[model samples]
Target: MSRRTLLQNAAIAGAAAVPVLLAGARSAGAKMSQTAVAYQGSPKGSSKCSNCKLFEPPSSCKSVAGDISPNGWCKIWVKA
Candidate 1:
């Protein structure tokens, strides 16, 4: 293969690997803190973390860090 073609292929491979590498690094590092996030006070008329699929029951979240509240709300909150 030409040098330019090889370089382009390597660049493409590297770019595709970026996300996977970052994901692994993140999973190995400290988790995100819910305190760092600005959660909404009270549910949006009827939406809350508890009812959300990401909710982890009691006080935890699947994608959020720190203690999660069923009554709390966040931007990523989704209906369960």
Candidate 2:
């Protein structure tokens, strides 16, 4: 697998380019900002995230399991 794909499937979430939260920074029930990222874009005719060059198909992510959300976006979102 390519490096990009490897990064996406990593068991270490922070190593996946996601920023790690400070340990003990939040108390119970504290609402943290939901950091949303925007897609830069991809080659025309692209249809799904699994098909993206950066996506690690057939694997689960730290946030979601069963299947990776092709529409999923994050601060690490990069153009294909």
Candidate 3:
């Protein structure tokens, strides 16, 4: 193949790989340790995991490691 054709094909392949790479990166997002985010088992006033945007329902947190409580509080909590 001509040098220009090879370069063009490489560019297209790179572009096609971008979405797959991004998807993997997104799916492998890292979560913070409970201690790192000052996680607590109870609410802080009215703020709690259930009301936080990062809450994953039942007993999980999108940004916190291990089992979480709906009534739990953390420094990273954001109003849902």
Candidate 4:
């Protein structure tokens, strides 16, 4: 294979591996939040999602800007 072709193949392989590596990293960090224990409150009360007040849906968590299980909670939770 030409040198350019070999380099291109290596680059493509590296790019493909990146997603797998990231997926593994995400799974390794798959853990529940500690905020569910109760409102410990952020050190400055600024990290609590419950205090943000912009958290809509009232049931969905807005802290992560993703699907946050209701069973879990975060410092940014706000009451509706």
Candidate 1, residues 1-80: lDDT per residue as tens digits?
A: 89999999999999999768645745786454565446765787788998999788798877677777689898767788
By TM-score, the best candidate is: 3
Instruction: Using lDDT, give the best candidate's number.
Output: 3
- Tens-digit per-residue lDDT, 1-80, candidate 2: 99988877775666644343422333233323324323323323444455445456554333322344665444443355
Cα displacement (angstroms), candidate 1, residue 19, comes to 11
lDDT-better candidate, 3 vs 4: 3
Judged by TM-score relative to the true structure, which candidate is superior, 1 or 4?
Answer: 1
The list of candidate 2 runs beyond 4 A from truth reads 1-53, 58-67
Cα shift from native, residue 30, model 4 (Å): 6.9
Candidate 4: worst-modelled 10 consecutive residues by lDDT? 36-45
Q: How well does each candidate superpose onto the true structure, as a TM-score?
A: 0.55, 0.25, 0.65, 0.38
Q: What is the lDDT of residue 69 in candidate 4?
A: 39
Stronger candidate by TM-score (1 vs 2): 1
Which residue ranges in model 4 land beyond 4 Å of their true spot? 30-80
* Better model by lDDT: candidate 1 vs candidate 2: 1
**Tens digits of per-residue lDDT for model 3 on 1-80?**
89999999999999999767645754789676899789999999999999999899899987788999999999888999
- Per model, state how many residue pairs clash: 1, 0, 0, 8
Clashing pairs in 1: 34-65
Model 1 lDDT at residue 72: 89
